[model samples]
Target: MNASMGPTLQTQGFYDRSTGTVSYVVWDAATRAAAVIDPVLDFDSKSGHTATRSADGLLAFLHGKELRLAWILETHAHADHLSAARTLQERAGGRIAIGENIRQVQTTFKTLYNLGREFLPDGRQFDHLFADGESFILGDLEATAMLVPGHTPADMAYRIGDAVFVGDTLFMPDVGTARADFPGGDARTLYRSIRRLLDLPGATRMFVCHDYPPQGREPCWETTVREQRERNVHVHDGITEDAFVAMRTARDASLEAPSLILPSLQVNIRGGQLPEREANGVAYLRIPLNALRTVGSMPARHGSA
Candidate 1:
């Protein structure tokens, strides 16, 4: 374990090759109080099958180390992978939590999916909702929530000790920042949020939720704030907010929707629980046909110039 002051902070990252996601387990050596950040449940979009293998690995680690699970923290509502937060809590025990702005995401998807009145947008799906700059405890480590929305309205970065779990906010310097075309996501807002994160003490360890590596490189999830500020393709030290927004918007226009966006959102908005089953005893995910517009985002409407 890496020692810091009286409490030692240690983190282990697990990469799921399928979605290129990196889930982390961060704990203190002096107390063994731990939290699982952005856990994933193995999902097969083709077969519609869900497995516990990925999360099980995390559980085994916690058990092996005799660590007490305190929080199952989600940085945001992901569009790429199914969340294993609920499953992890069930097996290992932790309070499921996410950014308070998840209500905005939940409300957006609830309308898109035409969910019944039973599904509330009150953020009740989670055990706790953290607001921006909220302070909390992780064993002996002090943590704070920094709302970094842009990829989505609810994205948050958790700062614990010298480490930060930045959920889809910023990526490895080469991979750049996350696309900010999702509903309720503004390129300008995201750029500002990212700049705020980069302004932190340079040596701060920034851990990303997903890593899309370049051809010559293997997946990497760790980068320092100093490195990101110096080399991040999307928003480095010299990149202005206006320029970043233009680049981000243009880039998002050319990108296709994530392969698992539909399935992931339906499940994730419910705090990783599948939609309630019908009388047939089966839970089903709804795919709203053409519900998401991706044909062309040309700002000029129709023939207007």
Candidate 2:
């Protein structure tokens, strides 16, 4: 533990500014045991190429620090970048985990994509489906999964020690929070979730999943609860529930959908693993074409251009 009374969390962030997704390797320095949160797999949609460059960066960092990986945790099925969890698990030796509600997400998307009966929506694709309030130990470190579902029905925030890795739930103060316009997203519920996170001990540190600063600015992911409470534009301490909902709703309505949304949802909802490869060894990504239009236009969310 740090002298400041915070858990001794050694975190090295590997940011893919292209997708604006941050993959983290966090460990307890003393025990040399680690967990990787949301590692990215570099996918080239144009060339249909998939590479492990992003995850390899994390692997190299872990080797440098001499830490053994204990678990691979996903904050939620991401909608922006492909997850390298499977590749990392193969190289790092740990089981993959996600929120139990992923089954609900998978079932919803599977039907939208018209996937066949062979696909099981029970989250069996993942090694572990963490329930809300579930706690697990990593060597001496304790990590708790909190259901903070607003970005999607299956969103989760991992509270490891005093530092919480809030996926799309909230961002650094300057960036505001994630949009609540995806399937199953509710602005009111998101507000409550943000409040719950802010209520954590005033000193608790928040490690956000992504950060996008202005041109030439470096991405910053670590901030304190006290700082967010005082300065977050959308959910600062004095913002009332109704006000936040109104602000969030208005902002969401004006935004555009994520560029990768079409391809992302189909793959992410299945635990970051790609869809079953088709015959001839080609992996096919199904696009519902006008399906999203029928569901209503999606407002843009933060992350990726």
Candidate 3:
């Protein structure tokens, strides 16, 4: 614990090596109330199997710690891994929530997937939808949600005490930042969003949702505003918006789509609920052929995050 952050806030990260994603359990030590951020639902594409091992581990931790679940937060609808929000909620009660801009993402994918009218894009799927700058209480801590779209249109960062969970907005300084080539993504917009987080106090703790470490370095998720602003290769202190955009655009062009994009988005948009079962009782995921530009493309610069 950072002495400056007081004794209330505590955080533990769960890393999913399969997807290179990190899920966090942050709680108020005094109140024992907690929030689970970006939990992963284990998925095997080859066999079309889903498991709760990852999420169940988190639940076990919560139970062992005697912490009360308050919120299950998603930074955005992910493209790389399935969400465990609904699964976690079924086992442990919490308000499952995400940014309100998810409606836009829902609309875009609904058309691409040709989802039926049964699905609604009104953001009702989530227990709550947070607007930019919205404030909420987690135990005794006051947390604020900040919209940080770039990698995706609905990305949000949660600021609790002195720590911020930046979902895909910025990776570790060595890894730079997330790609901004997805639908509704803009390099200029991403650069501005990154600057917003960096503007926080230099000592602010920044937690990344994903980390793809380079060779010889182990995975790490925690960094500071000061570290990012000073060492981030893509957008360091002296990097201009134009220069960053140019670099991101070129870099994203050479990347391939995430392996689980099809299944991940379908389940994620529904607040982590699998697609409604068909008459046969098996839920199906749609894959639009030759639809996404990233299909059959060259290898990704950084593997899915």
Candidate 4:
């Protein structure tokens, strides 16, 4: 367990290789009150099986540290992996939260997925919906939520003490930034949001949500604003907004949609709760035919048996 410690706050990151996601546990040293950020729910798309291994590991860590879970925070509704937020809240007794802009995301996906009258597009699915610059108490430490959209319209970064949990806005310096091509994402807007984050104190600790390492390099999730400014290949100090946008747009054009986007969003938009079970008690995810242009041409149709 690799942990970074401040005078009053402590942070430990849990990286899941299957999805390249890093979930964090941050706490106030004085009270042992903690929050879990962007936890992953293990999902096997082939078998349509879901497991609690990742969430269970977090629960075990909290129990071992004698930490009380005060919050289960989601950086955004993810597209690559299922979230473990609802499961963790059920097992540990903490409030689940996401950015208030999630209502926009919910509205968009609800239309695409046809989530019907039962699923409300409002942000009520979560225990709390944080607005930009909102402040809340985590034990004895004061934490603030910063709106950092562009990777998605609802992305948020949580700043607690000297550490900042930046969710998908930036990655490790060697890996660069997230692609701004998803729904409601804009390359120019992403550049500005990243610059806003770079404005923080140079020495502030920055923990990323995902890390896609290059050849011969190990996975890493932590960096600092100073290092990112000096070394981030995509948005270093001298890279202008125009240059970043041009590069991001071209790169995003070549990229395919996330493999689990269909399943992940359908579940994530519901605060990690699976869709309501059918009459046979099976919950199923919907995949709209020919909806995403990024997907290849449709297969030739064949007669049914």
Under the 3 Å rule for N, CA and C atoms, how many clashes does model 4 have? 0
lDDT of 3 by residue, 180-275 (tens): 878888889999999999999999999999988899988889999999999998998999999999998888887777888888998999999987
Model 1 spans > 4 angstroms off: 1-7, 294-305
Query: Which is the winner by TM-score between candidate 2 and candidate 4?
Result: 4
Tens digits of per-residue lDDT, candidate 2, 107-201, equal: 87887788888888999989999999999987688889999987778889999887889998998798899888777888899899999999999
Worst 10 residues of 3 by lDDT: 293-302
Error of 4 at 260 (Å): 0.7
Put down candidate 4 lDDT per residue, 101-158, tens digits, no spaces: 9999898888888778989989989999999999999999999999999888999999
232 Cα displacement, candidate 3 (Å): 0.9
How much is 205 displaced in model 4, in angstroms?
0.2
Candidate 2 Cα errors over 4 Å, as ranges: 1-7, 293-297, 300-305
Tens-digit lDDT track of model 1 for 154-257: 99999999888898988899989988878888889998899889889999988988888889998888889999999998788989888988898777767777
The alpha-carbon root-mean-square deviation between model 1 and the true structure, to one decimal in Å, is 4.4
lDDT of each: 0.85, 0.82, 0.89, 0.88
Clashes of each: 0, 2, 0, 0
**Which model, 2 or 3, shows the larger lDDT?**
3
Error of 3 at 31 (Å): 0.6
- lDDT agreement of model 4 with the native: 0.88
Prediction RMSDs, each to the true structure: 4.4, 2.8, 2.7, 4.8
Best by lDDT: 3
